[model samples]
Structure formats: structure tokens, C-alpha cells
Target: MREFPQISYAFAYGSGVFPQTDGSASRPAMSPHPNPPEAILKWQKGGGKMIDFIFATKFTQHFHSLNLNRHRDHYSFLGSFGSSIISHVQDDWGAGAYFNPYITVNGTLIKYGVVNFKTLLRDLSDWDTLYLAGRLHKPVKILTEDPNIRVANQRNLLAAVRCSLLLLPPTFTERQLYTTIASLSYQGDPRMSLGSENPNKVTNIITHQIRNFRMLYHDLIMSLPNVDYGEARALQQGWMEDLKLDRPMAQDMDPAFRGNMVRRLPKSFRQKLYFLYQRKFGISGREFEGMLEASADEDAKGGLKKPVGGPFDRRVAAETDLREMVLKCVNQTVKWPSATQSLKSALTAGPSRTLRYLKEKREKGRENALCDGTIVALLGDEGNESMDSSENTTEDG
Candidate 1:
């Protein structure tokens, strides 16, 4: 893409995208580890990490063939075969994302994933892998994008807001909404329990990119129906704790609410979700009761629990069934990256090197996370950058 504009979409995300600047974005959250003052934590993709980038094209095979020929060594042993093989594996075996790992650009360790425009749209619109969707949830500089794709992403943002609202309590603060949005990808990831990810990763992501999240979801917040979102229109530019969802909020998260949410999601997801329901609940044909049941966590009509933390603890929300369904889907999405990475590593470096590759990735994540979390500042060079479980690196395995 740097050489030509043949690709449909591309962008630079992570600390590598920007030159070294003051770490002020993260500095404010440095007071303490667990709870910080007015902390607008960085919610996704740690700073000074590997420069993560993704490219999507309408012509997958053609684009891959050209790029593979141009940078054969980047694909490890697989490039020697052909782009068709790589593309096949990426689509058939993986979650529609293929990466060229540890690529050296100006001595910088960078990795870029490639997926077709169709897969990108599906994943973005649906919360399938929540992979690319999770990354886009954070602020990333766009190198190139299609206008249609931009519109699709806006819909994705709206979906994010609505879904987060569904997952939240009857009354919530603006930070709660943003935090819920930030935690979407990590809700049920196996990696979160492994300590492979930083405990404060989500907090850091939202704190650092607070302004960006505000800009993205503010409109959706304003448009929410039947709720008291009027406080968002106050003198402040972003969401505030003053905002509250009325008692009717419980009714809003009904069967129709879930149907609307499903309709807005990508077709691929809708298909998979429907199949899951059919297989488990015998919900065949047009019956969507199973899906609605999954979306309707029990209402807070009983009584509001004492405030625990941001966005109301999952328990306090009283949506055990919905949360269970969420964990099932999110965990289902998290499983694919590991299998694909293992397959790719085995193909590239033989089965032996696969272990080494995974070991190295884990070590790098821990090492990078050890750096100061106070700011999403730029690293001096690529050598210092590392990718976290939040995005690019440390996703799984």
C-alpha cells in the first residue's frame, strides 16, 4: 500500500504510527494502579507497541500475489509456495485475517494482517472475532479507506454504543459506557485469565484515547430513545456521570431490541448466531426467541445493587443469562487466532519453531506491558515498541 493505492483499506495503529511525542495522553492516569483520579484510561492497543497495521482489498488473490512477490521473505516459508495458498488458509482456516509477522521495515519489527474487503465488512459489522472490530474501537490513524467502508464503520460504532448500553445498568455514567465499549473484546477472552494481558489494559486504553472515544460515540449517545441522555448535551463535550437511563430502560432491552441489534450486525454473524440457536435450542425457521433470550439479561426491576465500579459490575446488572451468552460467543471468537497462529507458525518455521514463536510473543507482551502505563506516549523507535493483548499482538496464544 505504501508503494501503490491498489488496496481498498489500510491504516497505521499503535505507537509506531506516530513519531515520539509527549506522553501526556497517558500521564494523567498515573496516580495509582487500580483506581486513578479522573482516569480516562487507554482502553485498547498499548502505546509504544509494535506499529500494527491492516489492509483489505476487494481482489484478495490479486493483491496478495503482487504483495507476496514484492516481499517474498516476509511470509516465511509459505511465501515460497504462492499467495493463493496463503489466502486460502487465511480464509478457510483462520478468521479471515492473515499476518506477515516480524517483518523488518527500517529495522522496525512490524506485523501487518491482510483480509479481503468482504471479510472486513462482515467482521466490522458483526462482533464475530471482535478482532479488527476491537482494534477499530480504539483510535487509529487511517492511511486509506473507502467511503463506503467509512459508512460501514460508523454503523459499527453505533452498534458498539447500543451493545454497550445493553450490557450496562439502567443508569450509568459516560465513562461507564466508554469502559463497556472498551471491554467488548476482552469480555470472555481466555487470555484475560492467563495474566498474558495487563490487568489495567482496558483502563489505560480508554484513559489515553478518551477524546477519540468521545468523538466516535457521542452522536449515538445523543440519539438513544426514551432515556434521559440530555446531560450529554451539557457544557462538557464528552459523556458524564450525570447522564442516566430511566426506569423504562429495562423495557427497551426487549425482544425487539435484540432483533434490531441482530439486523444491524453482519450477515455472517447473524447466520452463525442463528445456527447456534437452532442447534442448541431447536430454534429453526424464523423463530428468534433464543436470540432474544440471549440478549435480555434479567431486568434491574428488582432493585438496584450498590455501586461497585465503573459501568456497574456484571453481577449488579443482573444479566447472568445474557452475560453467559456473551462469554460463549466472545470466547468462541477468541479461540480462532490461536489455531491460525499455530498453523501459520508450523507452516513457516516447522512445528518446532512454532513454540518458540509463541513463547517470544508472550515474553514480548509481558515485557512491553512492564513499561509505564501512565501515558500512551510514542516510543523513540520501533526497537522499543511492543504489541499487547489489546491489539495486534497478545490477542491469543
Candidate 2:
């Protein structure tokens, strides 16, 4: 007889293999096997873990026979549904096979596990990078449940990187991968919880990578046949115009003034200015102020006077000061390296004035509408109807 590995443990094959058993010995076998004891002995001597649960035994056989290989590097064998083979083997079989429970390494199940693990690690990593990289809380659950479903760390990281690239176009690069990991590691450290230490290393890395990618792939990105460089240029020009306006306003006004102005300014104006400065000129707040002062001087010298017969009537000094500062900054920071006046004029011309006009017009219209509505409400319906009838008749005649 060939000596098989010693079975320190035994797994009873359930009804799936043979007959059902009641607790009592007198109970008839649902399906009796001629050599039940022999079969058990054979499995025992072969170093198999004793599977007591019938469901477990059936599942294990079914899964094992199916030999499902769902993912690249992982396979799943069913051995007792929801049963732990390692524990059973260790308890029943003396140090037999490695007794290790191995899940499919890169299949759906493993991917799910990896995703879950990544999420767990993310909270343990740098959260600022996650946020700045445009990753929110949703992917965490998906990743936690499946990491190995795709490629190993490669696919998981790539997917996250792609998402970051797509949502926040300004800060996506290959270098971000290493930087993000490093940042996570640093922030996750328990030592530097307070003080002057910057926790934004991950953000910095991401920024650097984006810069590098832009520089390296400039031609390729620009060369894409379907790409609309014209639209992009227009967008760039629009942003330049905005930065030209804001840099000065932000510079000339004190924080209190800025806060007040910000509150007073319409949302559209504020957003436009922010995008222009941030995207086009990349002018710092300090630089923006310097530009404002220069513009103010120019305006005082009668170089760029306020337009005649305009609501240039209200807060002329404040608005003039604001515009001058912004134009000055744009002139200084966004001028072509060749110092071309045409480029400067193009950036500072019609659009800026148009933006101001539209904003003022809208505000005035809103105020007028509110005042008219209040007056009408105070007047009786008869008066309101009379006013409407007169307007309608005037139009009809």
C-alpha cells in the first residue's frame, strides 16, 4: 500500500457524496454507500481536513471540480461554503499541506479585496492628496471590495491616476504616483501631527508631475488632429483677460476692502476673475497689487480715462482703482516675453469693459425689477392693471 500523507484531520463528505444521516444510528441512510467507512479512511490517510458540514463538503467538491480562474493570477476552488479550510486543516490534520487558505490572487475576489485594502490604506495615507487629486469618498467603497479584479497594483493605481487626471486637469502627471505614495506615507506617520510641518507634500508632488507632463507632452497634446486649439486659445485669452482685472483689484484693496468687495461683487464676476488669475497669468496676490497701483497712476495721468456718460457714475474712484490695478498686473505678468504692446492691448481691451458693463447692467436691472415689483404690490391691483393696459395700448398703437 502506498503511504499517503497522514491525515491528522478528517472531513466528512456530506449527502452530496453519499446518504443523509440523522443524529441516531438507526436512521436509514438517505443514500447509503457500500464503503462509507473506507472512503472516510481513505480521505483521512490522505491528510484532508475533516469537513463536517454537508454543505461545505458539497461546495468544496463543486468549486474544486469547476476550477474557476476568474482573474489573471488567481483561482477559486470551493471547499465548504463559507468554511475556513486553514483552521479546519490545522485542527484536524497535523501540519499536513501548508494549511494556508489562498484566495485567487488577481481575480475578481482578489481585486475586490485589494480595492478594500486600498481604501483602508487611503485613510491611512494622505487625505489632502486624495482630495486635491479629485478623489472623493465613493471610490473607497468600490476599491475596498475589489483591488485584485484588475491588474495588480498597476491597474488600481492607474485607474485612480486617470480619475485624478480627468477631474482636475491642472494637476495630473506620471510623477504623481510616487509623490502620492510618499505623501501618504508621510502624513500617515503619527509623529508630525502638529506644528509648522506642511502636510501637503502629496499635493506638491501631484503639482510637479502635472507641470512636467504638460511640458513634456506639449507638442503631442497640441498636435492631436481632432483637438480644437482655437477654442483652447480663446479660453486662454479669456483667462488672461480675467487675470488682468483681478490681479490689480486683489492688490490695491486691503483685506477688509477685498472682503467687502468680494461680498459686493456678483458671483459671476468673482468666479471669472479667480479663473483668469489662477489659470492664465498665475500671478500671486502680492504681484496683483503692484499691478493695480501702476494702473492707478496711469489712470490719474489721463492715459485710460473712464468712459463718458456711463454708470462710471457710481464709485468711479473705487472701480477705476480696481481696474487700473488689474490691468497693470496683466500688463506686467501676462505680456508676451517680447513686450508686444499689441498683445497687451488685445488682452486688456473690449472684453474687460464688456464684462464690467454686463455685470453693472444686470445689477441695475435686478434693482429696478425689485423696486417696480414692490411699487406694484403696494399699489392696488386696479392701478397695476391700469398701468399694464396703458403699456399694452401704447405698444398696439
Candidate 3:
């Protein structure tokens, strides 16, 4: 992939890179086949898994134009319209990404998405859309690295922690925290709600890759001023068991602190919050700007620099409608992008490929549902058996 033209940033993610076991229960059992040992080994290692990649280039049009000459088969009929048209479609729609799926490279199946580097930066720093930022919230294998992207992604990861903290209760298990963080991207995604995606997708990812999550977030979590582990545990594998938030942070009703958190959110999202807050509270634009300035005027020590305070900031922080406002902002940012990207994938992948992809996804979804049901039934039976044993012991007594 390093040989791929002008890819300033690239990464591989999904089950192919970070293997997950929970989905194995849902996967079909392999049928017996007569094959040479080497071929069988290769199939066992890589078959049926699609390695996913996202490539960000300096100029999307230039990259596509070059790619057109080199690998024209990667494009659908849309490729006939020329690189300029393809670039326009990619930049103007669907979270500013164009994906080409079901392509084979070096005898391995792969799917890659291309997006302009600038748009990728904006999404990371400003949360203009959670489309890519949400993906960064999870663990990934960074194939190509850009210094600027690394900084922006740090902000993205911190923002995810802050948002998850706000949504979570005072005392929560590590699982709860990670799940809330993971759920950020899927909040308004159509595939999740429409049942085309596996319901246990997030849980499975976290359950199998807790160490990966710790690697990504542990240090960032420690850096937070308001969050801490409930107990001092030995530094070993799986130490992220319990988390405790400061009393005020847990209640999250502190106007000043909450206001700071809201302000620190991505610029685009903060702007949306401003408009929503104004509409709900009937404040003027000037007043909102003043409150924003006050929130931003904080020192390295987290203390107010000037203390130009107002009730507006307090109201934004302590209002019961705060959670609703945040959700509305996220949905506004994610809902359209998620849907449009799905549509774009269909066009970019072509009819036969799109159908094959959807069929594979739906099959996984159905299998997950059945596996979940079986687990629930087994748990229920165990509960009944325990109750019956207790009753027999009491009678004997």
C-alpha cells in the first residue's frame, strides 16, 4: 500500500487486522475440501476476510487521475465519466469519501476508501462529520502516518473520552466506558438500526480487544483532570476494570466544568451546540459568542484566566436539556453522512459487488441474532436450575 500513489495517510482496520472471536460462533463451519496443504494453509490464514484500508491523499482528483491509468478496473462504470467527475462525486458527497470494495490485490481481498487529506483533517479536528473521526476512536494499525494527523487524532481521542464521560454514570465498569465510546459512531448509523449490521458488533469488538482499547486510551484517560480508576490495581493485563469520576464531574451539573467540556468539543459541533442552545434558550448570537469566549479563556492549569462569567454558560452546562442537545448535534453530524456513504458505496462498488456485500452483511446479522438468542436461553435455564436447587435444600432442612 505504500506504493499506492500519493497516500499521505493510510491505515488498516476491522477484523482482518484485529482478530475477533465472538463472530466465530456466527460464522458457518468450513466444509471438508480436497486441496493441497499449501493452498489449504493459505485459505485458513486469509480466505473470506477482506482487509479494509482508508487512504488520504493531498489531491483526490490527481490521485484518482493517476490511478485511472494504473488500475482502471478499481473503478466502476462511473470511471468512464473521467477522473474529474469521479473526484467531484467523491468530494461533494457522502462524508467526502469514495470507497472501492471487493478488489483483489496480491491474492488477498481488500477494500479501500479514498478521501482528500484536508477533509480528513477537518473531520478529525472539528467533527464536521463523525464519519472518519468515529473510526479513529477505536484501535487501528497505522500504515502511513502524518505528523499533523497524529496531533488532530489526539484531539479526536480526547474528545471521545470527554463525550463518553458525560454520557456515563459516576461509577462504571471499563466495559461500560469503552462501549459508550464505541457507540459514538453508530449513534445514527442506518445500518445498525436497519439490521443490516450485527447487533453485538461493538460488544464483540471490545470483548476481544480490551488490550487494544487500553493501548489507545489508557494514557489519555490518566491525563484527564476529572477521571480516575476506582482502586489502585497492579499494572498488568486487563487493569482497566473500574473507573471513578470526581463527584462534580459525575453529576456533571457543574456549569463551569461542563461548559469547558462543551467548548472543547470539535469546532463544528460546538457551533451546532451554539445554535441549538440559542434556539432553546432564546439567546442572541452575541451572547452565545461571549459565553464561548469565556469558556475558551482557560489557562494550562484549567483555571479561568479572566473570569468573564455569565448565566448563559451556567445554563448551557446545568440545563436538563444538555444531553438532548448533545445527541441532536451528533445525529445532525452523523445521520446524513452515514446514509450517503452507504449509497456511495453501492455506486462505487457496482451492482453485483454491492449485492454480494449486502448479502454477506445480512447473513452475519442473522447469525448474530440466533447466537444471541441461544445465549439468553441458556442463561435462563441456568437460573431456573439454581432456583430449583435452592428450593430442594430448604425443604430438606
Q: Which number leads on lDDT?
A: 3
Give the distance in Å from residue 382's predicted Cα in candidate 2 to where it truly belongs. 71
Give candidate 3's error at residue 359 in angstroms. 1.4
lDDT tens per residue, model 2, 56-77? 1113322322332222122223
Pairs of residues at least 3 apart in sequence or in different chains that clash in candidate 3: none
The segments of candidate 1 whose C-alpha lies over 4 angstroms from its true place after superposition are 15-48, 226-234, 237-320, 337-361, 364-397
Per-model C-alpha lDDT, please?
A: 0.54, 0.26, 0.71
Candidate 2 RMSD to the correct structure: 32.9
- Weakest lDDT window of 10 consecutive positions for candidate 3: 370-379
Q: Please, what are the lDDT tens digits per residue for candidate 3 over residues 1-397?
A: 4235777887666765555553334443331333424433333343346667789999989999999888899988889988999999899989999988877654446688999999999999889889999988887766667779888888898899877776766677666788889889988999988878888888777876676686677777767666776655524454544223211223344667666676667778877877897888887878777766655646668785653325665567777777777888888989999999899888888898899989987876764432211100111243224323321011111
Candidate 2 error regions (>4 Å): 1-113, 116-185, 190-208, 212-397
lDDT of 1 by residue, 29-67 (tens): 222224322211341222323456788889877887888
Cα deviation at 137, candidate 3, in Å, is 0.5
Q: How accurate is candidate 2 locally (lDDT)?
A: 0.26
Evaluation by lDDT, superior candidate among 1 and 2: 1
Alpha-carbon RMSD, each predicted model: 11.9, 32.9, 12.3
